[model samples]
Target chain A: MFPGPSAKCARLGHFLFLRSLTTEATCAVTRTPTLPVKQATRPQKSDKTSISTAIVLNRAPILTRSSTPFETAYYSYQARIRRALHNPFPYDFYFKQGTLIETRFNLEERKRERLAFGPAFLSKEDVSEEKRAADIAAVEQLAQQEGEGEVLMPRTHPSDTSGDVRSLDRKGQRNLYLLLHVLENGKETWRFPLGKVEKGQFLHQAAQKDLYAECGDEMDTWVVGKAPIGVYKPRQTSAEAQQASEIVFLFKAHIMAGQVKPQGDHIEDFAWLTKEEIKMRVHSHYWDGIKDILSDH
Target chain B: MSMQVASQAARHSLTRFQRAPKITRKLRRHPKTGLPTPHVKIVTREFAPSRLEEHYHTTLKDDLMYMTYKHEIGERPPPRQIRMTFDPEDPYSKYRHNAPVGGSQFHKKPAPSSSPDNVVRLEKIQLHTMVKEAVANKSQLLSAIMQMKALTGETFQGGGHHAVEGIQIVRAKKSVGGWIRPNVPVGVKVDLKGQAMYDFLGTLVEFVLPRLRDFNGIILPPQSSSIKTPSSVSGVVSFGLPPSALVFFPQIEVNVDAYPKLAGMHIHFVTNAIGVGAQDRARALVSGFQIPFLRR
Candidate 1:
């Protein structure tokens, strides 16, 4: 319905017409939306020229085209790292490719058919311990061959890292971030879900709201006013704030889950690790600080 | 009328009969008896924030601007990405191009599978185009852009009074573009010394960049799963200095975070050049200009 080539009238008359198709009426472009629009004044021939322009916000939605990017190296790092860092109960096993796209080899066509990114982050329950471990191993093996170096993760992969598949939602986009760190104890582990800024809300409130949203069952640790922090990357920008700047504080909070219950299923099937296990099992640089986080307590 | 109706009915019947599935002679039938086959099965496919993602500003501010890195590497499409190094010393040194063109000898992956590749490829192309355009405009200089907008723009309707001063600052920065103005670089250290300009600059860098980091790219974070059946914990990802590693100076770590000394954050507005053609060059051209405030 949106900006489709077929008009509404043509759509309604599809089967009624004798010819399989009808032609669209001519339309004229009255105006155009140019970007980083320049000023509407004459250009001066002076050696040093100054042009006046207008900066308008690109109010269009983001469109994505990628298939199963999570299968890529970055998400491989994400899936393994999160599970290792926080878990209520130690995982007994992990199965890889439980969510693999089941397809037979097509000799005529040599490529593998694919599935969605959801299966990677959403189906942790179905994967057997062995499979998850194997996939982690596979990813680690690839990382190992390249050699480890401290590199800041670029801000472009989650959307374009994969080769085949388009994002279902384009331009119309919003995101929920969980700035969580892990907690440690004997037989009991906890997740300290960081708060987030709401759309148009103050960054500080967003963080508190995020904390509360994830604070189900662990409301005891709820508190506002965390220290504001931020860094500049080529792409990071805020939505509520015009320039995507930050003025909110971040806090470090922990939980006492009281028992080894999987109150949050996302937290289930995760393995508990000592400092040694963390250094060994976790592969991504993002989690390089997990041991330090746990060591605090 | 009756005759016409009868003829039409005949035509309909004939059409249905002709359209009926054809038997591959004996293939559709059993050697001894005949029966039709059954049909096949069907398959199909949250926003919660607790996760951070690498962002490509495909759409930003109001979704009008797309921020893709403008590559200086000519003719060749930009790589899917230029790895951002923990070592802030070199930002675009290893921006290798890994974006492949097609599969095998002659065929490309089907369009469905190639969307991401196409987007990455297109974004690289667009980056170059943007650079060319920006370079063309550079003869034009960083043109001052003035924006006309609705004001009291700081408050949200939900009694939230949200301050999008960042956007306001950006818009104002653009407004300055409409008139000639000199830009203050982001990395060069300057004495803020109680200037309103410096105060605004400090707020902009301190509050905006980290959150904006993930959404500025072609990628976005995976949705947070259902809480009750939280199938998988949201993946945790971070890229910062390894605390144990000895740092030659604290400034490097702070700069690693894109903090400490960076300015013109108010001017880091990008045009829609992501996942499109010839955009990388435009951004790369902009990248050539150092932010006076940000230091290595």
Candidate 2:
């Protein structure tokens, strides 16, 4: 084993000499150490450094293999590493596949069957879809009529008269968040404005994008907050559930710019609710770790 | 009139069939004679049998469609108790992917478990202080050590005691006075684990980062950056503290009067993510803890 930092540093000096000689003069080289570098001193053809280098060379494999990561090496060296503060307890002894989709070998066939003949067999779904569409269209027409009465609602902005903004109970006081509920198997479940984080986007960006998409016309008013309020994992249904689960990084955004209205078709409904209301609306199981976010409001 | 009478007749027949009490025992057959004969006593209800029957009939009539539908679907037997194995592809396979994996699609991790328990956790906070020898020459090494001690509230030990070499060459400039040599004892640093590390991280993330005036946010290295160091993606994205921000660190802020020379150090929050995918989840987990990350 490498003795310690002193011995390690001396060996590092020898390696640096070999590496420096090979490199072009002043190339602005960036060297990422395979093993976390504890400390390295500049090599001068000195006997003291050379002696340590010989020892390191003989035990080079041991040094690289056993080297504690410079980051955690100290902890391991000291043996002062503590059990992780959070989740100190061991995981469930038995694997419980709660709501995660029980994988069937013939998933493709089953999915195909559902796609091809499921509607025919399950005609109620088609009728429900048509009925839901009609209901949504009716709701849209009513919302349009309400939008026409924009003067009736409290307007936060008053630059010029255009009654497009929805009035709030408390003008400019946006303590409420818009929650998007998706229709799954005819049941509406509450979820945060969450979508797949795009190729170039961060989780926060995705949250912002989904917020606008789910909120529809009132999207302009909501200002996305920088810090995530909390991350929640919604209970997955058989449908819409993927092999790997995703997290809902709920951002603390407010209705900064627009009036509230349901925007997306996938969304069955949208509501502005505080943490308590969310707790009341969502399943109790999902509200487990999210108690902290509730206390925030 | 015929339709109404027919429906009435059906309801009467259904209620009568349900509400009527039936005999509980079959007649005992005589083995020798090869003819059936009553031998055993019949079981009878002690309570108001008619009332109980009426309740069932009324309830069943009210939810006939549901009851019939349930019966049509057939009773699902209780889940069989079998040896649970760790196979991901099997349906009803109890193998849970509790371990965090990389990529954006997976989010249902905590469904089978709870957060911190289910989520990728911040295992340990690592503090790295590198003092340049040139800077140390201007200021005493003792002063740098004192500053680090004051800043981290931990005694300097290991690696940091030795002078760090400049891996890359610097162009000769007036700022340095002359050409810089590679060998020199610059300063001291120490790594903190467990409680001490957590306490420091809390202060930095909650108080220090926010208090910095020009601070936008920390930039997270993309997945590609973590490709080489498969084990430590979180460690690789080290926090870069500028010289100006040195005074603001809680340790230094209170003990500003102790030493004159102040040096900047990088704090790398290392998570114990096992794989690339897990490391990605670790990154996402940390970000969700209100640690803002700038998009690169």
Candidate 3:
């Protein structure tokens, strides 16, 4: 049962302005001075109101998106325009004459020129074939020594190829949300990690505690703000409806390092899913409630 | 045999004609100016993908919207009238600039109600440096100007954009009794926008900041510092980099000896955020770019 009006007022005063108040406390305080109009309107419902906090743990993109073919073409065209209009490079300021580095730069510049224009656009050099060949060889040797041709890490992770949903590394260029498959009312359901808000708890604080209680302390996570980003109201059965109407306040959090370790028996499994994947797993009504909150990309 | 010899002679003449080099048309010089006339105005745009720009669109934009969102039940009421305004209709002040009664209390103005379109974003970065020696002799400003040009690689109207004032010489506006004279150049600055801004930010974070010795982070003001200030409302986060740190810039590092003197610079990150506590929001956006901030 809800606390008495006098007790609630004292608790409210103690917590005021230090942390943001819960919806019930906020409504009560706003109306307490005038009249207990909210309590009078819903006498029985006020005592059985149920509130829970959910955490939307997120992983931001790791890699920059690859440009589409059209984008690539546009960039190249712009680059060509830039090259043609660029001012002359001050070679004397940056490079010494007859230095190997300068020689390498000159060779690279000619190659880029050929790519921008064509081989036919370049004037024929006065140097003999052997000298030109020697310069090329020297530059190649320098490049080899400097490890310039080392391969970069591939954009796609191994987990992506294997279709491992649990691995956080699966999607390198998409926002991934953490969703849990939990046993609710003897039925398995996919939802954000949810836990009941204890008495006198701030919603934001409850969100953090709930996340750790379900997801374990292995990961370092930061709740985004004091306010909840969104809310979800679950459909109630006749029996449950008679007991309490449930409300879930969803808070966004970022997982900086480590993976979620589902601690309790209530949480059956967990997956790092993109927005579309989440839609496929969660109920239609639930999706309708939270779809707008999830990022598209 | 006579016919064959005639045919061979004709073929040889045709081959010689084909081998001859043709003369190309030259660009005509303008009659008034003596400069070669080109048919078109050339403008160069973004030539490559901007990583930081993409990161903002993909990640930071969404996170910022969530973090800075203030939930409201209904449309915000019109702001309260703080002071009376001078009537323009008054005969004495009709032509004069009628200032507000309490001056423009811009610093105290409330932030615009949160909405999708008004999310804060960086507008541009301004790099400014003052050359002390330039006050003695104007020629000393050349080194600072050169340094700005080198650091940003911006030339006057370089990309054919008229608004792009690549690097500018800052001249004194008023004469101080003995230290300075009006119209004398004492400093240089460059404004970076678009791809150039992101590129500069990336270079600063990746190369310059990490290498600075004994640097913790851009320090924050004391906890009780007043938020109601012109700078706090203007949404500009300004900081200074010492002259010794100038060499850490990869561009300057390449030819450090070329510069006669290095001057410390003030960098201002100007964002689109406005109103009370705007600097806090701007700081949030900047910190998203991994420029760390430390509290005293």
Candidate 4:
């Protein structure tokens, strides 16, 4: 289903996915010689010269996918929401561990699509003019530098979980932030990896620290989107007291690169998954957090 | 919208998948124990590991006979075939793989009567002894440690023996977190030296854990040697001693271990009782093998 007439409405619905480039090169690239071409820069992050007797990767660069506006919007909301939930303000009571959200804001949802591209979405509750501009500047700069990629792993809302989010939000507008990232055919679900955030650590820092700690350090992340801030209490009277009352900043990261290496004594292995898949595999609240990241952004 | 934020989160699914154990058919049993439990496994595999190359075959494949010592400690059931085994000739076939020599050995074949009586050559490692898990965990962890040191924030001395977090781990961060934890046990080694079974065992006793850890529900007191025994640190541990005194004592060592806490384990220890009291203790240890509480 696609919108009609209006330029913005012309190819509105994201239902029709033309993923591959196998068709005759009708000059999508060839015709638009003037269109911006952002090369996937291999960030020559660090030199292994000292470590290797003969460094094979002299220019070994870490290839990062170009950022998308959808992803920027998602993360923007996530950081803000997480910040709000963790502050000394009394609003912490509202933030939940599993903030169920529907796929109410995918690229196809007409209202969502409209709001997604709006300056308002990024500007919401973002009071500090300077900080907001800095954030937007990063998004715009990344957008100009965005590389080419197919929307490969597109997930649709499942029937069972479709109405669950709508039922959870008190606003009755449907908290569409619990959907998980997955392959188009529904392969992997975006589930939170097993990790712990030490005290006095930033939520995002915790995400990175825990990742390196539990999952191998090779875990690459593509910030797909962000969601509303969630106040995730591990569990009342649980042993992980430090985690018992803390905010969770959830973002949809694509395991776009690297291997799922096992590192920690507590971990067995690591995986990249979508929400529906998590429903059948992982029996944990981490799945709910992943769902929020996919949907909220 | 911050690239700094999203950039860090984006890891390739391919990278994670590639690092995952080459998944074949999902295993029904555990990678460690054949028990159908998740803690015992993360990899879904049919066999424990291909690395477990210790297989024992006799002229009669089904006549699985292990070293009387291994059976004593219950590293595995007195050798049995992959499946139930019984001679075709026996009515209703009531024997198992380790059952005495029957009319037919490997099934459909006549019982092997020509081979030497004790000619049980190592055929294939059906199930692993403790040493096997070390082999599996070490090699796998070795590669991971290397990759970890290669991470941006991770710190390490490459091939050196400096510590990582708090433990004496050799490697540090490579990436962020994901799904599936390696069910295989990982112990920090001083070098790859601890990767070896004997060395790993030394670290476990001398460092990671102390004696009198626990057996079943009881806190086992470490056995002090009235006289020195001919066993290593692991051998001393096998005696169900306290975690404090894991040093070798003058006794047949017991081989009991757990990750850190003790709820269940295989009890390996020395028994001087021979002849008259042999059958009695053998029966008792056999029963102890099943009920950890009794042995504790």
Candidate 5:
């Protein structure tokens, strides 16, 4: 049940926080008003032309939510404490070869994701900080300068709204960072694509499936590296608090080729945010734990 | 990985020629006479042909039969059969030696049919440290090597082959200005392979990595490799061990008196293997041994 007046004030505070972030999002959307989803097929301005490609991403801007300072601090502290206590080795110590049992469906699901997501671009692997920055800027520029029609695959049937149609929107896609943010019952939150580790599925494979299910057959969007970025345990709701909590595995993916479309209605909406924008928009508690990782990118 | 390549090449050559055979002779005493019999017996042994050769032979036979039948010709001679004879003193042995005795080094170890779960192993653990100060003083280098050996329980090796000094030390005072010479051998390294590697890995994964300050386990980015077609350099996860964190290792921490200076080093794990999905297979094999992969 919702708390009394204090909870309402907290909610209002949260709303204000998001509103500030939304201003940035709205500016991006407004700049490219004429750009529609269908024009995504055509090639646009060269990414090398940096001047025209300022951050004009006006896609789903945030609407501020309410939260008390105390609540925010509490959650942040809780996360920090949890991280301090987290020990990944104890559970993994009994490791034996071939002990990781994976199911066929799960394996296929992971394979499909890897096949569709494409190669990931690591911020650290390729040498030269200047070059990596230039690449990121170029991608951001391309995503911004391109007309909406130039990047989007044409919408399929008019009747298909909350189905698999969006996921099948593979077309001439350029490399862009894919961030799946959830608007769960109007509470704005950013979470990378993730799902339950199915029976017989390895942790990494499950992450791939979750990413692929959300992004569809977008090339270079799949995670290829055998490792995960981090393991996150989300706070549970009161109703589900008694149940086993879910652990999230964040993977870095790049849009090597072909665009992506959302699969089903489980997610409210998705957007591609720049690394800086992600840092700014994510919840404070989440960001505190993930800032190091995001900085690497 | 190179071993696998050599085995494949050897198999290729073995299939192209008739294999050498071995002959054995035995004499038996007469049952009633209690004396050796004059008659001699001879036996011939041949290596089992590869499955590929057998398949090739059948297909070749079918082709010859079809040609003979199609032309409606008279009796066609049997296809030439190459006889493989063993000769211990054959001079050709110099150029082409017989296959190594016993099971193949490439054979699926333990048992061919058994599941290859533990086949992937921790090949080695290499510890490296860069001591820029050692470049100026020769004694410093010796001390650094001694410290490293004390920590790793293995003899330290010499200079790393790096182009253009990867490290730079700037003199803030400007009086001592200018960068240090480039490409200097300022570091010593030790590679703990075989059993030593496993021991080091066990200690690092189970104890050191977990306790290292502000340290998260190594991350394997999914984009590093694709399962459909693995690249030779794919599936390699490399991370650095900061000097600040090295002190936490049980061996190093307890013997703090030995190390006057600390240096950082990089660790790289090459997970190359055979077959489709080799990258993932190698990763899973590593994880099964309890080394947690930090997802990033």
Candidate 6:
């Protein structure tokens, strides 16, 4: 079980305290104009002030990032130092003497030690050549009986090789964000799923609703918090200046299950892209606003 | 002088078959304390990469920051002055310790502003267990001490660090009517940090919890419970493991019969988070490590 919905409500209360403060400041700024002018223009200005909620639906890294060559080398060096300086292993406590398991462990340990310190570091083993061969064979047989050897799944997914940006499984080691290719101004533009906040709707609630409305209700998603992670304002042209000045509040949400099914014709296509890929597809101004909110890895 | 010269002359005329005398070196010691010369201190550090540590950096840090962030438009208003400080000009107060007018309102303190550096993370894990029988006979504490040592693999001041207080003896703080006496050893405790902390956590999650019967995750307090309690602000999440669950630990599972009695431990996860709602943040961090929580 997780923190109940009430916990979110309590957090929303905290966010409201700051929201009230900001609202008060804005209210004061609007009151600076002449009383008659303010009263007459208030309704028109309110109508022109557009607030929208956008969901930066994210898929967290499913796999650990592979270490760089330098990191691997450093780690191996540190491991060798640890091995050289470690306390003696209690063989009697862990394994019975003259047992096959103990013999196998010794063989494995010797191989590891030789790898760390080089072959010449150890003296010749007292055991005869035939006995050593027999021990190795017995260990191999035991390993087979226990089904010890199994190939691990490759680090890179099949979708990655195929360059499938739509597949959620494509980037396992990077934070992939859902970017919708939508018809804006009769042209295709890549952006996060965005929709205007309905009357009396909370920003976070609007974000959740917009995500499901655009991406479909099939996916299980959880919005991160009550407060928006960041905010983005679209550049207004002179022709559109008379229209509403749009403010998009971005809320982060994680998709636990299901794929994006673009609900309608408005959403032309959708791609799960990493931060770098998202930057390439979206407008530079749009990227500048949302880049910091998205994780690099 | 004549005898010494004659011996030197005789030594120069030695036979070719004569063997050379072996040379012996004396042990080096410090002149001041008369102790043997010490070897260079070697302190071992993290030997391998920690999976949980990496997870904290890559995933949990960013998520926690976003979740716990409070949007502040401007500088925070200074904390409310509950009590005025005694003036230094007042000689009466200057000579004595000045206490707050009421009491310290530490529990009411607000959380620090969220930052990347201050994201809630586990600092250390304290595993403590009180053995009742140990009060009766001090030797009864051996089994508990052995259990602690085996569980943590820590010794007093291990890894050449004086700050490392491995397994510690918890003594009774106050005298009880018939049960405990002050300064009497009754319990064992160990504080695990860095690699050891993660290792203990991994074992608990992978080997212990799943096998623990009747556990449906740790139960949360009722929704009406007060969040302003001192424990809530201390940034500690405490839970007790049943004695029967001790066997589930692989270290103890190997030699269950070695100890006469097993003791249940109270594990406290201490985190960097402090101030109001700190326990919740601590719990969030712990749950990130895959320790489950439940609401009843």
Q: Which candidate, 3 or 6, has the higher lDDT?
A: 3
* Candidate 6 lDDT, A21-106, residue by residue in tens: 56556656767655657644543222255678889998988887877655655666666666775567877766777998899899
After the best TM-score superposition of candidate 6, give how far the Cα of residue B129 lies from its true spot, in angstroms: 1.8
lDDT, candidate 2, A180-284, per-residue tens: 578866877775555554443444445556555555554344322233444455555533332333345444444435554666576776555545666787777
TM-score of each: 0.15, 0.32, 0.86, 0.18, 0.27, 0.83
**B169-219, model 1: which lDDT tens digit per residue?**
111122244443343221111111112222322333344333343323222
For B1-296, candidate 4 gives per-residue lDDT tens digits of: 69866654443221112232445555477568675533231211111111111111101121111111111122333334433345656666744344444432222221122223522222111101122233334554433232222111122332122432311343323332552234444433222211122222333334433343443332333444322222321111232333233322211122122112211112333332232223223333322222233322
Alpha carbon RMSD to native, model 5: 32.8
Runs in model 5 lying further than 4 Å from the true structure = A1-297, B1-119, B156-183, B222-235, B270-279
RMSD of each: 32.7, 35.5, 10.0, 33.5, 32.8, 12.1
Fnat, model by model in order, equals 0.02, 0.00, 0.49, 0.00, 0.00, 0.24
Candidate 6 CAPRI assessment class: incorrect
Interface RMSD of the candidates, in order? 21.7, 37.4, 10.4, 26.6, 34.3, 15.3
Q: Which 10 consecutive positions of candidate 6 chain A have the poorest summed lDDT? A: A39-48
- lDDT tens readout by residue for model 3, B1-296: 99999976654343222232444667678899897765668788888899999889887887788777765667788876655366777888788877778888877888887888888898999999989898998898888887888889998988899999999999899988989888988999999999999999999999999999877888999988998989898889989999999999989998899989899999999999999889999999999999989998
lDDT of 4: 0.30
lDDT: which candidate is best? 3
Against the true structure, whose TM-score is highest?
Answer: 3
Error of 5 at A291 (Å): 51
Where model 1 places Cα greater than 4 Å from the true spot, the runs are: A1-196, A222-225, A229-250, A256-283, A288-297, B1-296
Model 5 achieves a DockQ score of 0.01
lDDT of 6 by residue, B73-109 (tens): 5899987766636865697888777777666887898
DockQ of each: 0.02, 0.01, 0.26, 0.01, 0.01, 0.14
Candidate 6 share of real interface contacts: 0.24
Q: Rank candidates, TM-score, best first.
A: 3, 6, 2, 5, 4, 1
CA lDDT scores, all candidates in order: 0.27, 0.44, 0.84, 0.30, 0.45, 0.82
Q: Which ten residues in a row have the lowest lDDT in candidate 5 chain B?
A: B63-72
Candidate 3 segments exceeding 4 Å error = A1-47, B1-38, B80-89
